[model samples]
Target: MPVPATGRLQWTDVPTPLRARLEDALDAPVTDTNTPAGGFGHQLAAALTLRGGRRVFVKAAPDADPLTAANVHEAAVLQALPPGAPAPSLLGVHRASRWTAVVIAHLDGPHPDLSPASTDAEQTWALLDKLTSSPAPAPYRAAVSATPSTAASLHGWAELAADPPADLPAAARDRLQQLAELETAWPALACGDRIVHGDLRADNMVRDHHHGVTFVDWAHATTGPACIDAASLAPQLVLAGHTPEDVADLLRDHPATATSPETTTAFLTALTGHWHRNARKPAPPGAPGLRAYQHRAAAAGLALLSHRLS
Candidate 1:
Protein backbone atom coordinates (compact mmCIF):
# COMPACT_ATOMS: atom_id res chain seq x y z
CA MET A 1 0.00 0.00 0.00
CA PRO A 2 1.22 3.52 -0.75
CA VAL A 3 1.10 5.12 2.68
CA PRO A 4 0.26 8.81 2.50
CA ALA A 5 2.57 11.26 4.23
CA THR A 6 -0.34 12.00 6.54
CA GLY A 7 -0.41 8.27 7.38
CA ARG A 8 -3.65 7.71 5.53
CA LEU A 9 -4.14 4.33 3.90
CA GLN A 10 -3.78 4.64 0.14
CA TRP A 11 -3.83 2.49 -2.95
CA THR A 12 -1.98 -0.80 -3.01
CA ASP A 13 -1.70 -3.77 -5.32
CA VAL A 14 -5.10 -5.29 -5.71
CA PRO A 15 -5.48 -9.00 -5.08
CA THR A 16 -4.84 -10.81 -8.40
CA PRO A 17 -8.43 -12.01 -8.83
CA LEU A 18 -9.86 -8.60 -7.99
CA ARG A 19 -7.47 -6.93 -10.43
CA ALA A 20 -8.51 -9.37 -13.17
CA ARG A 21 -12.16 -8.69 -12.47
CA LEU A 22 -11.59 -4.96 -12.61
CA GLU A 23 -9.72 -5.27 -15.91
CA ASP A 24 -12.50 -7.32 -17.42
CA ALA A 25 -15.13 -4.90 -16.19
CA LEU A 26 -13.25 -1.89 -17.57
CA ASP A 27 -12.72 -3.68 -20.89
CA ALA A 28 -9.09 -2.61 -20.94
CA PRO A 29 -5.76 -3.64 -19.49
CA VAL A 30 -4.40 -1.39 -16.76
CA THR A 31 -0.93 -0.45 -17.95
CA ASP A 32 0.42 2.16 -15.58
CA THR A 33 -0.82 3.14 -12.16
CA ASN A 34 -0.11 6.50 -10.65
CA THR A 35 -1.26 7.94 -7.32
CA PRO A 36 -3.09 11.17 -7.94
CA ALA A 37 -2.90 13.97 -5.42
CA GLY A 38 -6.02 14.75 -3.39
CA GLY A 39 -7.71 14.32 0.03
CA PHE A 40 -8.06 11.32 2.33
CA GLY A 41 -10.48 9.53 0.05
CA HIS A 42 -9.69 5.95 -0.96
CA GLN A 43 -9.56 6.35 -4.72
CA LEU A 44 -7.04 5.81 -7.51
CA ALA A 45 -6.92 6.10 -11.27
CA ALA A 46 -4.75 4.30 -13.79
CA ALA A 47 -3.83 4.92 -17.39
CA LEU A 48 -4.86 2.04 -19.62
CA THR A 49 -3.51 1.20 -23.08
CA LEU A 50 -5.99 -0.44 -25.40
CA ARG A 51 -5.42 -2.28 -28.70
CA GLY A 52 -4.60 0.70 -30.95
CA GLY A 53 -2.34 2.55 -28.51
CA ARG A 54 -5.35 4.46 -27.29
CA ARG A 55 -5.36 5.42 -23.62
CA VAL A 56 -8.01 6.02 -21.00
CA PHE A 57 -8.01 6.79 -17.29
CA VAL A 58 -9.67 4.22 -15.06
CA LYS A 59 -10.63 5.23 -11.52
CA ALA A 60 -11.80 2.89 -8.78
CA ALA A 61 -12.86 3.11 -5.12
CA PRO A 62 -12.56 -0.40 -3.85
CA ASP A 63 -12.65 0.58 -0.21
CA ALA A 64 -15.71 2.79 -0.23
CA ASP A 65 -17.43 2.43 3.14
CA PRO A 66 -20.78 3.82 4.25
CA LEU A 67 -19.74 6.69 2.04
CA THR A 68 -20.56 4.43 -0.88
CA ALA A 69 -23.99 6.01 -0.88
CA ALA A 70 -22.39 9.33 -1.74
CA ASN A 71 -20.54 7.77 -4.66
CA VAL A 72 -23.75 6.18 -5.80
CA HIS A 73 -25.44 9.56 -5.56
CA GLU A 74 -22.67 11.06 -7.66
CA ALA A 75 -23.23 8.45 -10.35
CA ALA A 76 -26.86 9.42 -10.38
CA VAL A 77 -25.90 13.08 -10.60
CA LEU A 78 -23.75 12.35 -13.66
CA GLN A 79 -26.54 10.35 -15.20
CA ALA A 80 -28.88 13.33 -14.81
CA LEU A 81 -26.52 15.87 -16.33
CA PRO A 82 -27.41 17.57 -19.60
CA PRO A 83 -25.30 17.15 -22.70
CA GLY A 84 -21.97 18.98 -22.84
CA ALA A 85 -21.78 19.30 -19.09
CA PRO A 86 -18.07 19.53 -18.12
CA ALA A 87 -17.99 16.51 -15.78
CA PRO A 88 -16.93 12.98 -16.68
CA SER A 89 -19.35 10.31 -17.83
CA LEU A 90 -20.32 7.50 -15.46
CA LEU A 91 -18.97 4.26 -16.89
CA GLY A 92 -19.93 1.49 -14.41
CA VAL A 93 -20.48 0.55 -10.76
CA HIS A 94 -19.73 -2.70 -9.01
CA ARG A 95 -20.84 -3.50 -5.47
CA ALA A 96 -19.91 -6.29 -3.07
CA SER A 97 -20.22 -7.10 0.61
CA ARG A 98 -17.25 -5.07 1.79
CA TRP A 99 -16.58 -2.61 -1.05
CA THR A 100 -17.96 -0.63 -3.98
CA ALA A 101 -16.24 0.81 -7.04
CA VAL A 102 -17.14 3.28 -9.73
CA VAL A 103 -15.58 3.67 -13.16
CA ILE A 104 -15.65 6.88 -15.16
CA ALA A 105 -14.66 7.88 -18.67
CA HIS A 106 -11.17 9.38 -18.62
CA LEU A 107 -10.85 13.13 -18.53
CA ASP A 108 -7.48 14.41 -19.68
CA GLY A 109 -6.91 17.83 -18.27
CA PRO A 110 -4.46 19.74 -16.16
CA HIS A 111 -5.37 19.86 -12.50
CA PRO A 112 -6.66 23.39 -12.11
CA ASP A 113 -3.72 24.63 -10.11
CA LEU A 114 -5.71 27.69 -9.16
CA SER A 115 -3.93 30.99 -9.48
CA PRO A 116 -4.98 34.62 -9.70
CA ALA A 117 -4.40 34.35 -13.44
CA SER A 118 -5.86 30.85 -13.85
CA THR A 119 -9.29 30.47 -15.46
CA ASP A 120 -10.55 28.33 -12.56
CA ALA A 121 -12.83 31.00 -11.15
CA GLU A 122 -14.45 31.61 -14.51
CA GLN A 123 -14.79 27.91 -15.26
CA THR A 124 -16.18 27.20 -11.79
CA TRP A 125 -18.85 29.84 -12.26
CA ALA A 126 -19.86 28.29 -15.57
CA LEU A 127 -20.09 24.84 -13.98
CA LEU A 128 -22.14 26.22 -11.12
CA ASP A 129 -24.55 27.73 -13.59
CA LYS A 130 -25.12 24.34 -15.11
CA LEU A 131 -25.49 22.57 -11.76
CA THR A 132 -27.85 25.03 -10.07
CA SER A 133 -30.01 25.56 -13.11
CA SER A 134 -30.73 21.88 -13.42
CA PRO A 135 -32.84 20.04 -10.90
CA ALA A 136 -31.25 17.23 -8.91
CA PRO A 137 -32.41 13.75 -9.83
CA ALA A 138 -34.55 11.84 -7.31
CA PRO A 139 -31.88 9.49 -6.01
CA TYR A 140 -29.41 12.30 -5.43
CA ARG A 141 -31.99 14.30 -3.57
CA ALA A 142 -32.94 11.32 -1.48
CA ALA A 143 -29.34 10.60 -0.62
CA VAL A 144 -28.78 14.15 0.61
CA SER A 145 -32.00 14.12 2.55
CA ALA A 146 -31.02 10.89 4.25
CA THR A 147 -27.65 12.13 5.41
CA PRO A 148 -27.64 13.43 8.99
CA SER A 149 -26.95 17.08 9.66
CA THR A 150 -24.05 17.81 12.00
CA ALA A 151 -25.06 19.08 15.42
CA ALA A 152 -22.82 22.11 15.12
CA SER A 153 -24.42 23.09 11.86
CA LEU A 154 -27.94 22.67 13.22
CA HIS A 155 -27.25 24.57 16.46
CA GLY A 156 -26.81 27.85 14.53
CA TRP A 157 -24.81 30.95 15.44
CA ALA A 158 -25.63 31.77 19.07
CA GLU A 159 -24.37 28.43 20.30
CA LEU A 160 -21.28 28.65 18.16
CA ALA A 161 -20.41 32.10 19.51
CA ALA A 162 -21.07 31.23 23.13
CA ASP A 163 -18.78 28.26 22.82
CA PRO A 164 -15.90 29.62 20.78
CA PRO A 165 -12.74 27.60 21.06
CA ALA A 166 -10.40 28.97 23.74
CA ASP A 167 -7.20 28.15 21.88
CA LEU A 168 -7.79 30.42 18.85
CA PRO A 169 -5.90 33.69 18.60
CA ALA A 170 -7.71 36.75 19.88
CA ALA A 171 -8.20 38.14 16.39
CA ALA A 172 -9.62 34.91 15.09
CA ARG A 173 -11.77 34.58 18.19
CA ASP A 174 -13.20 38.05 17.65
CA ARG A 175 -13.94 37.29 14.04
CA LEU A 176 -15.74 34.13 15.03
CA GLN A 177 -17.87 36.13 17.43
CA GLN A 178 -18.67 38.54 14.62
CA LEU A 179 -19.57 35.61 12.42
CA ALA A 180 -22.06 34.45 15.03
CA GLU A 181 -23.61 37.91 15.11
CA LEU A 182 -23.92 38.02 11.36
CA GLU A 183 -25.39 34.55 11.16
CA THR A 184 -27.97 35.50 13.78
CA ALA A 185 -28.94 38.63 11.89
CA TRP A 186 -29.06 36.86 8.57
CA PRO A 187 -30.68 33.68 9.73
CA ALA A 188 -33.25 33.66 7.00
CA LEU A 189 -30.95 33.46 4.03
CA ALA A 190 -32.43 31.55 1.14
CA CYS A 191 -31.28 28.01 0.54
CA GLY A 192 -32.23 26.78 -2.90
CA ASP A 193 -33.15 23.18 -3.63
CA ARG A 194 -30.61 22.41 -6.31
CA ILE A 195 -27.77 20.01 -6.85
CA VAL A 196 -24.62 21.48 -5.34
CA HIS A 197 -21.10 20.11 -5.73
CA GLY A 198 -20.87 20.75 -1.94
CA ASP A 199 -17.04 20.65 -2.11
CA LEU A 200 -15.65 22.78 -4.97
CA ARG A 201 -11.96 23.23 -4.28
CA ALA A 202 -9.48 23.52 -7.15
CA ASP A 203 -8.20 20.02 -6.43
CA ASN A 204 -11.52 18.59 -7.62
CA MET A 205 -11.29 20.43 -10.93
CA VAL A 206 -9.25 19.65 -14.03
CA ARG A 207 -8.73 21.55 -17.28
CA ASP A 208 -8.41 19.06 -20.08
CA HIS A 209 -7.00 19.74 -23.53
CA HIS A 210 -10.37 18.88 -25.10
CA HIS A 211 -12.76 19.48 -22.25
CA GLY A 212 -12.24 22.94 -20.91
CA VAL A 213 -13.13 21.99 -17.33
CA THR A 214 -14.13 18.79 -15.51
CA PHE A 215 -15.07 18.27 -11.86
CA VAL A 216 -14.35 15.15 -9.84
CA ASP A 217 -14.78 13.95 -6.25
CA TRP A 218 -18.54 13.96 -6.14
CA ALA A 219 -18.77 12.41 -2.68
CA HIS A 220 -20.00 15.71 -1.31
CA ALA A 221 -22.82 16.19 -3.78
CA THR A 222 -25.99 17.38 -2.13
CA THR A 223 -29.30 19.12 -2.71
CA GLY A 224 -28.66 22.42 -1.00
CA PRO A 225 -28.05 26.07 -1.70
CA ALA A 226 -25.23 26.65 -4.15
CA CYS A 227 -23.94 29.07 -1.54
CA ILE A 228 -22.59 26.14 0.47
CA ASP A 229 -20.55 25.05 -2.53
CA ALA A 230 -19.33 28.60 -3.00
CA ALA A 231 -18.44 28.81 0.68
CA SER A 232 -16.53 25.54 0.41
CA LEU A 233 -14.47 27.01 -2.41
CA ALA A 234 -13.78 30.26 -0.57
CA PRO A 235 -10.99 28.79 1.60
CA GLN A 236 -9.41 27.05 -1.37
CA LEU A 237 -9.69 30.20 -3.46
CA VAL A 238 -7.73 32.11 -0.87
CA LEU A 239 -5.14 29.35 -0.82
CA ALA A 240 -4.93 29.68 -4.61
CA GLY A 241 -3.89 33.35 -4.29
CA HIS A 242 -7.24 35.01 -4.94
CA THR A 243 -7.83 38.07 -2.81
CA PRO A 244 -10.90 38.34 -0.62
CA GLU A 245 -12.00 41.18 -2.87
CA ASP A 246 -11.80 38.87 -5.86
CA VAL A 247 -13.93 36.22 -4.14
CA ALA A 248 -16.44 38.80 -2.93
CA ASP A 249 -16.67 40.23 -6.43
CA LEU A 250 -17.37 36.81 -7.89
CA LEU A 251 -20.06 36.15 -5.29
CA ARG A 252 -21.67 39.54 -5.86
CA ASP A 253 -21.71 39.11 -9.64
CA HIS A 254 -22.97 35.54 -9.69
CA PRO A 255 -26.50 35.26 -8.36
CA ALA A 256 -26.18 31.53 -7.83
CA THR A 257 -22.84 31.76 -6.11
CA ALA A 258 -24.29 32.94 -2.81
CA THR A 259 -27.55 34.14 -1.37
CA SER A 260 -26.08 37.44 -0.22
CA PRO A 261 -22.73 38.91 0.67
CA GLU A 262 -23.42 38.71 4.42
CA THR A 263 -24.51 35.09 4.16
CA THR A 264 -21.41 34.16 2.20
CA THR A 265 -19.20 36.04 4.61
CA ALA A 266 -20.76 34.38 7.62
CA PHE A 267 -20.37 30.93 6.08
CA LEU A 268 -16.71 31.45 5.26
CA THR A 269 -16.03 32.91 8.67
CA ALA A 270 -17.70 30.05 10.51
CA LEU A 271 -15.94 27.45 8.41
CA THR A 272 -12.53 28.94 9.12
CA GLY A 273 -13.28 29.41 12.79
CA HIS A 274 -14.24 25.79 13.07
CA TRP A 275 -11.02 24.74 11.36
CA HIS A 276 -8.85 27.01 13.49
CA ARG A 277 -10.38 25.66 16.68
CA ASN A 278 -9.75 22.10 15.60
CA ALA A 279 -6.20 22.73 14.43
CA ARG A 280 -5.14 24.11 17.83
CA LYS A 281 -5.66 20.68 19.31
CA PRO A 282 -3.03 17.98 19.28
CA ALA A 283 -2.85 16.23 15.92
CA PRO A 284 -4.81 13.01 15.74
CA PRO A 285 -2.97 9.85 14.85
CA GLY A 286 -2.63 9.59 11.06
CA ALA A 287 -4.01 13.06 10.36
CA PRO A 288 -1.11 15.50 9.98
CA GLY A 289 -2.89 17.49 7.28
CA LEU A 290 -5.41 18.68 9.82
CA ARG A 291 -2.99 21.31 11.12
CA ALA A 292 -2.17 22.56 7.63
CA TYR A 293 -5.85 22.71 6.80
CA GLN A 294 -6.41 24.66 10.00
CA HIS A 295 -3.85 27.30 9.07
CA ARG A 296 -5.27 27.59 5.57
CA ALA A 297 -8.80 27.87 6.94
CA ALA A 298 -7.75 30.56 9.43
CA ALA A 299 -6.08 32.54 6.70
CA ALA A 300 -9.15 32.25 4.52
CA GLY A 301 -11.45 33.35 7.33
CA LEU A 302 -9.33 36.36 8.19
CA ALA A 303 -9.02 37.42 4.58
CA LEU A 304 -12.75 37.26 4.01
CA LEU A 305 -13.51 39.01 7.27
CA SER A 306 -11.03 41.76 6.52
CA HIS A 307 -12.67 42.37 3.18
CA ARG A 308 -16.15 42.41 4.64
CA LEU A 309 -15.23 44.76 7.48
CA SER A 310 -13.35 47.09 5.19
Candidate 2:
Protein backbone atom coordinates (compact mmCIF):
# COMPACT_ATOMS: atom_id res chain seq x y z
CA MET A 1 0.00 0.00 0.00
CA PRO A 2 1.52 3.28 -1.12
CA VAL A 3 1.21 6.39 1.05
CA PRO A 4 0.46 9.09 -1.54
CA ALA A 5 -1.99 6.49 -2.77
CA THR A 6 -2.20 4.94 -6.21
CA GLY A 7 -3.74 7.34 -8.69
CA ARG A 8 -6.23 5.62 -10.98
CA LEU A 9 -7.53 6.71 -14.36
CA GLN A 10 -11.21 7.49 -14.57
CA TRP A 11 -13.67 5.44 -16.61
CA THR A 12 -14.00 8.54 -18.81
CA ASP A 13 -10.30 8.32 -19.62
CA VAL A 14 -11.00 5.45 -22.00
CA PRO A 15 -10.78 7.09 -25.39
CA THR A 16 -14.09 7.31 -27.19
CA PRO A 17 -12.87 5.08 -30.00
CA LEU A 18 -11.55 2.52 -27.52
CA ARG A 19 -14.73 2.52 -25.45
CA ALA A 20 -16.78 1.98 -28.60
CA ARG A 21 -14.50 -0.85 -29.60
CA LEU A 22 -14.85 -2.47 -26.20
CA GLU A 23 -18.60 -2.05 -26.54
CA ASP A 24 -18.50 -3.91 -29.85
CA ALA A 25 -16.34 -6.69 -28.39
CA LEU A 26 -18.82 -7.20 -25.60
CA ASP A 27 -21.71 -6.75 -28.08
CA ALA A 28 -23.28 -4.18 -25.82
CA PRO A 29 -23.03 -0.51 -25.06
CA VAL A 30 -21.12 0.50 -21.96
CA THR A 31 -23.63 2.09 -19.63
CA ASP A 32 -21.53 2.73 -16.54
CA THR A 33 -18.13 1.87 -15.03
CA ASN A 34 -16.48 1.56 -11.65
CA THR A 35 -12.76 1.75 -10.94
CA PRO A 36 -11.25 -1.08 -8.89
CA ALA A 37 -8.19 -0.52 -6.74
CA GLY A 38 -5.90 -3.11 -5.12
CA GLY A 39 -2.31 -3.20 -6.37
CA PHE A 40 0.40 -0.93 -5.03
CA GLY A 41 0.65 0.97 -8.33
CA HIS A 42 -2.20 2.17 -10.45
CA GLN A 43 -3.19 0.89 -13.85
CA LEU A 44 -6.40 1.64 -15.72
CA ALA A 45 -8.80 -1.04 -14.37
CA ALA A 46 -12.56 -0.82 -14.37
CA ALA A 47 -15.66 -2.96 -14.09
CA LEU A 48 -17.77 -2.00 -17.06
CA THR A 49 -21.50 -2.50 -16.79
CA LEU A 50 -23.02 -3.02 -20.19
CA ARG A 51 -26.43 -1.76 -21.27
CA GLY A 52 -27.60 -5.40 -21.34
CA GLY A 53 -26.54 -5.65 -17.67
CA ARG A 54 -23.48 -7.86 -18.21
CA ARG A 55 -20.39 -6.83 -16.26
CA VAL A 56 -16.79 -7.28 -17.37
CA PHE A 57 -13.43 -6.10 -16.13
CA VAL A 58 -11.13 -4.19 -18.45
CA LYS A 59 -7.62 -2.86 -18.09
CA ALA A 60 -6.15 -0.33 -20.47
CA ALA A 61 -2.92 1.61 -20.64
CA PRO A 62 -1.02 3.53 -23.29
CA ASP A 63 2.16 2.14 -24.85
CA ALA A 64 4.06 4.82 -22.99
CA ASP A 65 3.08 3.24 -19.71
CA PRO A 66 5.12 0.27 -18.48
CA LEU A 67 1.99 -1.68 -17.59
CA THR A 68 0.70 -1.94 -21.17
CA ALA A 69 2.98 -4.85 -21.95
CA ALA A 70 1.96 -6.57 -18.75
CA ASN A 71 -1.71 -6.00 -19.57
CA VAL A 72 -1.27 -7.67 -22.95
CA HIS A 73 0.73 -10.52 -21.50
CA GLU A 74 -1.83 -11.11 -18.78
CA ALA A 75 -4.61 -11.42 -21.34
CA ALA A 76 -2.68 -14.02 -23.28
CA VAL A 77 -1.70 -15.92 -20.16
CA LEU A 78 -5.26 -15.98 -18.83
CA GLN A 79 -6.59 -17.20 -22.15
CA ALA A 80 -4.26 -20.18 -22.05
CA LEU A 81 -4.65 -21.02 -18.39
CA PRO A 82 -4.98 -24.68 -17.54
CA PRO A 83 -8.31 -26.31 -16.71
CA GLY A 84 -9.77 -25.44 -13.30
CA ALA A 85 -7.29 -22.64 -12.71
CA PRO A 86 -9.00 -20.09 -10.44
CA ALA A 87 -8.72 -16.99 -12.60
CA PRO A 88 -10.77 -14.76 -14.85
CA SER A 89 -11.37 -15.63 -18.50
CA LEU A 90 -10.19 -13.32 -21.23
CA LEU A 91 -13.12 -12.10 -23.34
CA GLY A 92 -11.14 -10.06 -25.85
CA VAL A 93 -8.50 -7.42 -26.26
CA HIS A 94 -8.81 -4.02 -27.93
CA ARG A 95 -5.42 -2.85 -29.16
CA ALA A 96 -5.01 0.26 -31.31
CA SER A 97 -2.77 3.25 -31.72
CA ARG A 98 -0.14 2.00 -29.25
CA TRP A 99 -2.85 1.72 -26.60
CA THR A 100 -4.12 -1.59 -25.30
CA ALA A 101 -7.23 -2.63 -23.43
CA VAL A 102 -8.00 -6.16 -22.32
CA VAL A 103 -11.49 -7.28 -21.39
CA ILE A 104 -12.14 -10.27 -19.18
CA ALA A 105 -14.92 -11.90 -17.20
CA HIS A 106 -15.66 -9.70 -14.20
CA LEU A 107 -14.68 -11.37 -10.90
CA ASP A 108 -16.23 -9.96 -7.74
CA GLY A 109 -14.34 -10.56 -4.53
CA PRO A 110 -12.62 -8.86 -1.64
CA HIS A 111 -8.83 -8.77 -1.63
CA PRO A 112 -7.27 -11.29 0.78
CA ASP A 113 -5.94 -10.18 4.15
CA LEU A 114 -3.18 -12.47 5.45
CA SER A 115 -4.57 -12.48 8.95
CA PRO A 116 -4.40 -15.90 10.57
CA ALA A 117 -7.70 -17.83 10.53
CA SER A 118 -9.40 -15.21 8.38
CA THR A 119 -11.63 -16.46 5.59
CA ASP A 120 -9.43 -14.54 3.18
CA ALA A 121 -6.48 -16.57 4.39
CA GLU A 122 -8.34 -19.84 4.03
CA GLN A 123 -9.53 -19.04 0.51
CA THR A 124 -6.08 -17.86 -0.54
CA TRP A 125 -4.47 -21.06 0.75
CA ALA A 126 -6.91 -23.04 -1.36
CA LEU A 127 -6.17 -20.88 -4.40
CA LEU A 128 -2.44 -21.44 -4.01
CA ASP A 129 -2.94 -25.14 -3.53
CA LYS A 130 -5.01 -25.37 -6.70
CA LEU A 131 -2.65 -23.17 -8.75
CA THR A 132 0.52 -24.91 -7.62
CA SER A 133 -0.89 -28.20 -8.83
CA SER A 134 -0.47 -27.03 -12.42
CA PRO A 135 2.71 -26.19 -14.26
CA ALA A 136 3.16 -23.16 -16.52
CA PRO A 137 1.39 -23.71 -19.84
CA ALA A 138 3.13 -24.25 -23.20
CA PRO A 139 3.37 -20.55 -24.01
CA TYR A 140 5.31 -19.90 -20.85
CA ARG A 141 7.68 -22.79 -21.54
CA ALA A 142 8.28 -21.50 -25.07
CA ALA A 143 8.55 -17.81 -24.29
CA VAL A 144 10.89 -16.25 -26.86
CA SER A 145 12.46 -13.69 -24.59
CA ALA A 146 12.59 -14.19 -20.86
CA THR A 147 11.29 -11.29 -18.83
CA PRO A 148 14.10 -9.64 -16.84
CA SER A 149 14.02 -11.49 -13.54
CA THR A 150 14.01 -9.84 -10.13
CA ALA A 151 15.46 -13.05 -8.72
CA ALA A 152 18.97 -11.91 -9.57
CA SER A 153 18.22 -8.54 -8.03
CA LEU A 154 17.09 -9.91 -4.65
CA HIS A 155 20.64 -10.24 -3.35
CA GLY A 156 21.01 -7.00 -1.44
CA TRP A 157 22.85 -8.50 1.50
CA ALA A 158 25.95 -8.86 -0.66
CA GLU A 159 25.92 -5.12 -1.19
CA LEU A 160 25.01 -4.42 2.42
CA ALA A 161 27.92 -6.57 3.58
CA ALA A 162 30.22 -4.48 1.41
CA ASP A 163 28.68 -1.20 2.59
CA PRO A 164 26.19 -1.52 5.39
CA PRO A 165 23.23 0.91 5.35
CA ALA A 166 22.96 3.11 8.43
CA ASP A 167 19.46 1.80 9.05
CA LEU A 168 20.42 -1.84 8.67
CA PRO A 169 18.78 -3.86 11.40
CA ALA A 170 21.14 -4.68 14.23
CA ALA A 171 20.33 -8.39 13.98
CA ALA A 172 21.25 -8.39 10.29
CA ARG A 173 24.36 -6.30 10.75
CA ASP A 174 25.50 -8.69 13.45
CA ARG A 175 25.29 -11.59 11.06
CA LEU A 176 26.29 -9.84 7.85
CA GLN A 177 28.99 -12.40 7.03
CA GLN A 178 26.61 -15.34 7.45
CA LEU A 179 23.97 -13.49 5.42
CA ALA A 180 26.46 -12.81 2.64
CA GLU A 181 27.29 -16.51 2.34
CA LEU A 182 23.64 -17.57 2.63
CA GLU A 183 22.66 -15.27 -0.21
CA THR A 184 25.27 -16.83 -2.51
CA ALA A 185 23.36 -20.12 -2.46
CA TRP A 186 20.06 -18.35 -3.22
CA PRO A 187 20.14 -18.40 -7.00
CA ALA A 188 21.16 -22.05 -7.02
CA LEU A 189 18.55 -23.06 -4.46
CA ALA A 190 15.86 -21.28 -6.46
CA CYS A 191 16.12 -23.69 -9.40
CA GLY A 192 12.93 -25.73 -9.86
CA ASP A 193 10.54 -26.99 -12.57
CA ARG A 194 7.09 -26.00 -11.38
CA ILE A 195 5.43 -22.80 -12.54
CA VAL A 196 5.67 -20.06 -9.94
CA HIS A 197 3.45 -17.01 -9.63
CA GLY A 198 6.60 -15.09 -8.60
CA ASP A 199 4.46 -12.44 -6.96
CA LEU A 200 1.96 -13.76 -4.40
CA ARG A 201 0.36 -11.37 -1.93
CA ALA A 202 -3.02 -10.11 -0.77
CA ASP A 203 -3.49 -7.65 -3.61
CA ASN A 204 -2.96 -10.33 -6.23
CA MET A 205 -5.75 -12.50 -4.78
CA VAL A 206 -9.51 -12.34 -4.30
CA ARG A 207 -12.40 -14.51 -3.12
CA ASP A 208 -16.16 -14.22 -3.45
CA HIS A 209 -19.28 -16.26 -2.88
CA HIS A 210 -19.42 -17.29 -6.51
CA HIS A 211 -15.83 -17.93 -7.63
CA GLY A 212 -14.55 -19.40 -4.35
CA VAL A 213 -11.01 -18.05 -4.88
CA THR A 214 -9.33 -16.19 -7.71
CA PHE A 215 -5.80 -15.00 -8.33
CA VAL A 216 -5.34 -12.08 -10.70
CA ASP A 217 -2.29 -10.39 -12.24
CA TRP A 218 -0.35 -13.05 -14.07
CA ALA A 219 2.41 -10.66 -15.10
CA HIS A 220 4.99 -12.37 -12.90
CA ALA A 221 4.11 -15.91 -13.84
CA THR A 222 7.20 -18.00 -14.58
CA THR A 223 8.60 -21.52 -14.70
CA GLY A 224 10.09 -22.24 -11.31
CA PRO A 225 9.60 -24.55 -8.35
CA ALA A 226 6.01 -24.98 -7.11
CA CYS A 227 7.43 -24.08 -3.73
CA ILE A 228 8.40 -20.55 -4.74
CA ASP A 229 4.97 -18.90 -4.72
CA ALA A 230 3.83 -20.52 -1.49
CA ALA A 231 7.09 -19.68 0.23
CA SER A 232 6.87 -16.13 -1.07
CA LEU A 233 3.45 -15.81 0.52
CA ALA A 234 4.96 -16.67 3.90
CA PRO A 235 6.54 -13.30 4.62
CA GLN A 236 3.47 -11.44 3.45
CA LEU A 237 1.40 -13.43 5.87
CA VAL A 238 3.88 -12.56 8.62
CA LEU A 239 3.64 -8.91 7.67
CA ALA A 240 -0.12 -9.25 8.00
CA GLY A 241 0.35 -10.35 11.65
CA HIS A 242 0.84 -14.11 11.42
CA THR A 243 3.96 -15.28 13.18
CA PRO A 244 6.55 -16.82 10.91
CA GLU A 245 6.24 -20.10 12.80
CA ASP A 246 2.48 -20.04 12.42
CA VAL A 247 2.81 -19.71 8.65
CA ALA A 248 5.30 -22.58 8.60
CA ASP A 249 2.96 -24.77 10.61
CA LEU A 250 0.11 -23.99 8.28
CA LEU A 251 2.06 -24.63 5.08
CA ARG A 252 3.53 -27.92 6.24
CA ASP A 253 1.02 -29.95 4.29
CA HIS A 254 1.34 -28.00 1.01
CA PRO A 255 3.02 -30.12 -1.67
CA ALA A 256 5.00 -27.14 -2.87
CA THR A 257 6.83 -26.13 0.31
CA ALA A 258 6.33 -29.49 1.94
CA THR A 259 9.87 -30.71 1.21
CA SER A 260 11.84 -27.56 0.51
CA PRO A 261 13.07 -26.28 3.84
CA GLU A 262 16.43 -25.02 2.59
CA THR A 263 14.85 -23.56 -0.49
CA THR A 264 12.34 -21.69 1.58
CA THR A 265 15.06 -20.38 3.86
CA ALA A 266 17.11 -19.18 0.91
CA PHE A 267 14.15 -17.46 -0.71
CA LEU A 268 13.21 -15.62 2.48
CA THR A 269 16.83 -14.69 3.01
CA ALA A 270 17.02 -13.16 -0.45
CA LEU A 271 13.74 -11.31 0.13
CA THR A 272 15.11 -9.92 3.36
CA GLY A 273 17.86 -8.44 1.25
CA HIS A 274 15.44 -7.33 -1.44
CA TRP A 275 13.31 -5.32 0.95
CA HIS A 276 16.26 -4.19 3.02
CA ARG A 277 17.71 -2.55 -0.07
CA ASN A 278 14.49 -1.08 -1.49
CA ALA A 279 13.32 0.24 1.86
CA ARG A 280 16.42 2.40 2.10
CA LYS A 281 16.11 3.91 -1.34
CA PRO A 282 13.90 6.71 -2.65
CA ALA A 283 10.31 5.63 -3.15
CA PRO A 284 9.22 4.99 -6.72
CA PRO A 285 6.73 7.35 -8.32
CA GLY A 286 3.03 6.82 -7.46
CA ALA A 287 4.08 4.49 -4.61
CA PRO A 288 4.81 6.52 -1.54
CA GLY A 289 4.36 3.81 1.05
CA LEU A 290 6.21 1.12 -0.87
CA ARG A 291 9.51 1.70 0.90
CA ALA A 292 7.95 1.44 4.35
CA TYR A 293 6.10 -1.67 3.28
CA GLN A 294 9.36 -3.18 2.06
CA HIS A 295 11.02 -2.42 5.36
CA ARG A 296 8.26 -4.19 7.24
CA ALA A 297 8.43 -7.12 4.83
CA ALA A 298 12.18 -7.27 5.33
CA ALA A 299 11.67 -7.50 9.07
CA ALA A 300 9.17 -10.27 8.68
CA GLY A 301 11.55 -12.13 6.41
CA LEU A 302 14.41 -11.71 8.86
CA ALA A 303 12.26 -13.17 11.61
CA LEU A 304 11.51 -16.20 9.47
CA LEU A 305 15.07 -16.64 8.29
CA SER A 306 16.40 -16.32 11.84
CA HIS A 307 14.42 -19.31 12.91
CA ARG A 308 15.57 -21.38 9.96
CA LEU A 309 19.15 -20.24 10.30
CA SER A 310 19.22 -21.11 14.00
**Candidate 2 structure lDDT:** 0.75
Score each candidate by Cα lDDT: 0.62, 0.75
**What TM-score, over all chains together, does every model reach?**
0.80, 0.90
Output the lDDT of residue 47, model 1. Answer: 48
How many backbone clashes can be found in candidate 2?
Answer: 1
Worst 10 residues of 1 by lDDT: 148-157
Candidate 2, TM-score vs. the true structure?
0.90
Writing each residue's lDDT as its tens digit, candidate 1 over 207-266 gives 777877788767666565556666666667788888878876776677665455666665
Q: What is the C-alpha lDDT profile of model 2 across 1-310, one tens digit per residue?
A: 1222457765676677877777787889989888766666666788889997889988887777878878877776777677678778888989766678988888887786678767777767777777767666676555512564555346888988999988787889889898888788888776555656677878877675597667887776666667777878888889888987888676566777777776766777787888887788887776656788888888988877776676
lDDT of 1 at 185: 42
